[model samples]
Target: MRRLMQIACAVAAWASLSLPLSAAPTEPENCPGLIASRDALVSRAALRQDEVGLTFVGHATFLIETPQGVRIATDYSDGTRPPVPPDVATMNKAHSTHFSYRPDPGIKHVLKGWNPAGGPAYHDLTVQDVRIRNVSTNIRSSGGGTEYDGNSIFVFETSQLCIAHLGHLHHTLAPEHLKKLGRIDVLLVPVDGGYTLETFDMMEVLRSINASLMIPMHFFGPSTLNRFLSSAREHFPVEFSNTAAITLSRAALPKSPKILVLPGH
Candidate 1:
């Protein structure tokens, strides 16, 4: 009887060890839940016709509008607001100008990049025609130490396009980070020589991502923006737009990667 009891206890221990860890759930690049609802959502939004509109809102902010009339403001803060209230707003608290504590009550979804309680900030939800998710990255703290998961690279997927905004990124991306990003069609990046990654390092990141369209943001003025543009011209053809807004579609993407500079709002 004693031997049998020992055998039973050992089997129970082995079973527990074989069980998968449930403490931390792994978030996939393309969440299955978001895909599951696509059929229902896509059928309703006939206006998009496989295209989306992107408008530069200045100072690291861009307004993304989906075909189904869903609007999203990236890096939303007190400094900038869409002409009309956005259905969703994604903010990175890297600086006072990138995030606001008091957002308008009319805005529906407000996503923050940092987890104040000391964990990775996680956002994985779909609203209307746009599905939004985030990959957490570290930032430099005011005290000068590294703050882990202090920022997020927000990705918006809709109309078969993946748009990513690198919010206050300070370091080069790791292999793991790239894996989470998947395939990015359009990348809204910071071109400020010093505030974000150094110009050369930022260039390296741009090459690594190999996005089809690179939009410069967070630049103080034309001088810094021009410097990045000259370096980028080596790889991507530079195009300056007189307007702040541009409509994009998968079918109409440029044959090659290009750096598109848009007027700040």
Candidate 2:
């Protein structure tokens, strides 16, 4: 009986030693639980199965071309119009430049980030190879008061990659917001510093999101852009691109978080 008891104790100790020291959960490969409901009427072959093309069309607008040729314009407005009409156009009502009353009629979907009826705007739809959703946040009114659920952070899921566009964001993200936004592979962030969140606060927001790749937008000029970049370099490596467009893939994402500065605002 004593010999049997010693053997049992040794086995238990060995099993405990074999267990991993830290059982921290691994990061998700893609945004889970975000499923696209609608199917696209048309499918145009353009990019590879795992590729997404992004063009910095100026301001908060980025032309996102999916693998199935679904074109999407972020912060779509008259000033930041893409050369080619997009299939889906997302707009925010923070200012006249962010939203348009009359978007091109050719656009199949016009998603507004705010509801004129005075509540949160909700959107969840899929077009071609992409699933689009929005998580609403608040904004500051002209009178310096809070406008609850006035802004949106649009998330685009396609090619196993999750990309988020932070539109005229006025504050940092909450825990609930992070839960809704799943795993973001790429982030389109506004670096105007004053117009959105201040540079430091915006950096905090970026850290909270922790996207592998971050693209800066909505900057007024080089001064504002440089100011943000100067501070950002301390935290993450910065890459300056000569062109305004770049193609991204999930498998090719940087191992370490990086800030990619594309030409144009």
Identify the candidate with maximal lDDT.
Answer: 2
Per residue, candidate 2 scores C-alpha lDDT tens digits across 1-265 of 4533343343332111100011111322335211010112112343567767777888999888887888999999988878878999999988978988889999999999998898999887878778788889999999999999889999888877788999999999988788777788889999999988999999999899898889999998899999999999989988766556566666667777888787776
Which candidate achieves the best TM-score against the true structure?
2
Cα lDDT computed for each candidate against the true fold: 0.75, 0.77
Q: Which stretches of candidate 2 lie over 4 Å from their true place?
A: 1-46
Residue-wise lDDT of candidate 1 within 154-180, one digit each (tens)? 988887778889999999999999888
Candidate 1 stretches with Cα past 4 Å from truth are 1-47
Candidate 2, position 237, lDDT: 87
**Model 1: how far residue 73 lies from native, Å:** 0.3
Give lDDT: candidate 1, residue 187.
89
TM-score per model over all chains: 0.83, 0.84
Q: Report the Cα lDDT for residue 87, model 1.
A: 90
